[model samples]
Target: MASIKLNNVTKSYGHGAKALQVIHGVTSAIADHEFIVIVGPSGCGKSTLLRMVAGLEEITGGEISIGGRVVNALEPAERDIAMVFQNYALYPHMSVFDNMAYGLKIKKVPAEEIKQRVAKAAGILELGKYLERKPRELSGGQRQRVAMGRAIVRQPQVFLFDEPLSNLDAKLRVQTRLEIQKLHRELGITSLFVTHDQVEAMTLAQRMIVMNAGRMEQFGTPEEVYNRPATTFVASFMGSPPMNLLRHAPNADFGGKPGAILGIRPEHLQIGATGWAVQVDTLEMLGAERLVYCRMGDEFLIVRTDESLSSAPDIGATIHVAPRHDRLHWFDAETGKRLP
Candidate 1:
């Protein structure tokens, strides 16, 4: 296990006047055996950042260090890192055992040692029974496990995962996520996983980096990112229904407070008798909870409530809802930055 460090790391294409910069100055320190996840929307530079750490993409400026050694000029293999790609990059003809042993063979490890390594990895990943099966003979989930086993056999200082669970079905994704948690607990190898799925980031990361555009929006534990976002972009991007950002508070009657935006989560607004009066525009029942889309004048917001607490309201019916004062978030309207 090893620590990874990035100091003002950046990436760009072209040069001089025509240069298009993708990653801005991103700086962070990942501790040894830490599981860090980089999450963002598509084309937001999250994957580019991970690739830079893997030495697969060149940094335009600054430095990258692994286990205290600067690796700006090091190749991927020389960096002592193993990568698991989304497509389950496995050999079609080779059996599971051979695919996992291929890397060890390339390094000229003894046959007995290779066998032992493969067997141990298979046992950990529960692939011991399918060692003789080829890639085509296994299911998608099984194939993914084989790919992970191959990486485990390398015993690299760092593990890089690029949307490794994107190809699996919803149920398999959940199952594999559990397996991944177990793997990390047992191996304790430093890992960097990149994904567009916020749920995955929230569930898997010990610390997560939330990216937007080409900048690092925030880096913290899931609770910090979700509870107190640093900016409007983080506020609106990280949640499922997202935060309701309004230019004016409902029932204030004076348009809105100048230079400030109010942010409240869907669950933070409660239906009550004496508060902002809103007309219920729509309602969606989602298992144990319900989403109520409401309108107050021209501003629109959503209210999330438990289905067991009360019955659903009819569309266009007027209802009063109160915002939890403690949960309210304020931002600078012009800069979209959180306010003190």
Candidate 2:
């Protein structure tokens, strides 16, 4: 395993005045054997950043180093990294065994060693029974495993995954996620996974990089990013129901600070008698929880409540809800940055 470093890494399409800059001075140090996920919305440059590290996309400025060696000019193959793409790039005609063994064979590894490597990878991925099966004969999950197994046998210093689970069904995605966690635990290879799914990032990443438009909004553990976001963009982007950003708060005190946007998570709002009176717009029952959509003056607010705690209120009914004092987050109204 190897540590990766990005020092002010940047990317641009054209040159001079018409240049279109995508990545903007991204800098981070990925420790050895760390599983870091790059997550963001579409067109946010998360994939572009990963591609730059994989040597697939050239950096416009700054430096990329792998295991203490500068690799700005290195080719993908020379970087000693394995990539698992969203589409399982498997050969239709080749069996799983041949597919896994192809890389070692091309490197002219001994035939016996190739068999051992392929067998070990197949065992890890539970593909031993499907070794002789062709790509057409395998399920989507199985094919993806084969692709991962192919990478595992190479024993690269780094592993790059570009939305490897996007094509799978929801259930399969969950299953494959578990398998990947297991794989990382057993092998402990340094991995960089790029995904647009925040749930995946939160579940799979030891550390996550949240990107927006081409700049990195935040980089931290899932808990840090979720609990104390650095900016309004992260506050709104990383959550499922998302943080409620109120430009005009219902209260006058404004959480003891003035002239800033207020942020409150849906779950933090409590139905009370002495607070903001809001009209219920809608209610959605989601198994154990309920999302109460309400309109407070001109601003919309969503309150997440446990179903066992309270019954749902009728739509169009006015209700009072108070935000937890300690849970209130303040951000600059103009800059959208978090305030102390």
Candidate 3:
């Protein structure tokens, strides 16, 4: 496996009036055998950054290196990396065995060696029994595994996953995500994954890069991004239901406020005996816990509450939504930059 590095890489489309920079000057290093997740919103350039590394998109400036060798001039096939696309991209008519063996065949690996490698990958992906079936016959999850298996058989220097689980159902996504994690652990290959899903980023990455508007917003561990976000955008975008910055803002949503945004996660907001009194707009019971969407000042916020509370508030019920003082976060009112 190889360590990947990008130096001041950029990508811009067209000239002058029609020009738009899609990838800013981004520089980072992904170490050997590290599982790095690149996450951002739609149009945030996460995929573009990944495609650049995969040699599918050219870098406008600077260099990209794999295994200490500059590969900016190399073709996709010459990069020594296997990419797993968002769509399974398996051949419709080919059997799973044939699909898995295609790349090795292209490289002219011996037939016995190809069979050995494909069998090993199929066994690891739990697809050994489906070798004779075509892609259409498999479930979404199974098809995704086959796509991954195709990558595994190549035994390249790196594995690139471009949101490979996005096509599966919610339940299947979770299961496949776990399998991918386990597979990564077992294989220990340098892998870079791209996804817009924050949960996927949080769960799969050893280190994650959060991108915004083609720029690097933050690059750190999942805890570092979620707990101590470098910018307000990172704060609001990284959590489930997100942190409630409204409670800390005197006038939150409409501007002219003290800060551009105040940030806190849903889990940080709790029902307390004393705090800002709120009007409950809705109460959503989500099995083990409840979500209390309440009005704090002029802004609405979501708080996680215990399901066994003695008295659950009515839709219009007044209650107190308090934040854990130690876990609070603040940002500049106008710039949306995190306050120190």
Candidate 4:
């Protein structure tokens, strides 16, 4: 296990006048054995940052250090890091055991030691029964496990995962996520995982880096990001239904300064008799909970509620909704930054 640190790391394409910067002075400290996920929308530079850390992409400026040693010029193999890619990247021609042992063989490790390492990795990944099976003979989840097995056998100082669960089915993704948690608990390796899915970021990371258009938007635990978003982008991006960001309306009771935006989570908006009036547009029943989509003047709002109510207001009907005062989030309208 090792700590990873980034100091003003940057990446760019072209040079001089035509240069296009993709990463803008990203800096963070990842402690030894900590699992950090970099998450954002597509084309937001999450994968690029992960690749930079893995030494697969060149850093345009600043430095990256692994286990307290500078590795800005080191090659991927020399960094002592193992990566599990989105595609699994298993060789079709080789059996599971051979694929896992290939890296050890290339390094000319002793035959007995290679066998022992492969066996132990297989046991940890529950791939012992499929050691002789080729990649094509296994299911997608099994092949992914084999990829993880390959990395585990390397015993690298850090683990890099680039959307490793993106290809799995919904149920398999959930199961594999639990498996990964177990593996981390047992091995305690420093890991950096990149994904576009906020749910994955929420569930997998001890802390997460939220990126946007190549800039680091926020870095904190899931609870902090969800509860007190740093900016409008984070407020709108991290939640399922997302936080409702309303322009400062002069007549509305939801209080805010003239130039501030009001933010309220879906669950925080309650149906009441003394607040902003809304015209119901639609309602969605989701078993234990319900979502009310309504129009308040020119702005649209979504409210999450339980099914315990005896009745719901009909579409096109008028209803009053009030946001929880203490739960409100305020942002600067011009900069989209959180307001104290």
Ranking by TM-score: 2, 1, 4, 3
* Candidate 3 residue lDDT tens string, 79-182: 89999998999999999999999999998999999999999999999999999999999999999999999999999899999999998899999999999999
The CA lDDT at 52 in model 4 is 94
Please report, as a residue range, the 10-residue window in candidate 2 with the lowest summed lDDT: 250-259
Question: What is the per-residue lDDT of model 4 for residues 1-340, given as tens digits with 9 covering 90 to 100?
Answer: 8999999999999999999999999999999999999999999999999999999999999999999999999999899999999999888999999999999999999999999999998998899999999999999999999999999989999999999999999999998998898889989999999999999899999999999999998999999999999999999999988999989444345556777888899999889787788999999998888999989888998999887973688999999888888899989999999988
In angstroms, the error of model 4 at 31 is 0.7
Candidate 1, residues 1-340, lDDT tens digits: the string is: 8999999998999999999999999999999999999999999999999899899899999999999999999999999999999999898989999999999999999999999999999999999999999999998999999999999999999999999999999999999999999999999999999999989998999999999988999999999999999999989988989999988676253334566999999999999887888999999999999999999988999999999999899999999988887788888998888888
Clashing pairs in 1: none
Give the Cα error of residue 8 in candidate 2, in Å.
0.4
Going through the candidates in the order shown, the clash numbers are 0, 0, 7, 0
Estimated TM-score for each candidate: 0.97, 0.98, 0.94, 0.97
Q: How does candidate 3 score on lDDT?
A: 0.89
Q: Can you rank all candidates by lDDT, best first?
A: 2, 1, 4, 3
Look at candidate 4 and tell me the lDDT of residue 319. Answer: 93
**What's the true lDDT of residue 95 in model 4?**
99
* Candidate 2 per-residue lDDT over residues 74-132, each given as its tens digit: 99999999999999999899999999999999999999999999999999999999999
Kindly report which residue stretches of model 1 are placed more than 4 angstroms away from their true locations once superposed: 251-257
lDDT of each: 0.93, 0.95, 0.89, 0.92
Best by lDDT: 2
Instruction: Show the lowest summed lDDT stretch of 10 residues, model 4.
Output: 248-257
Count steric clashes of candidate 1: 0
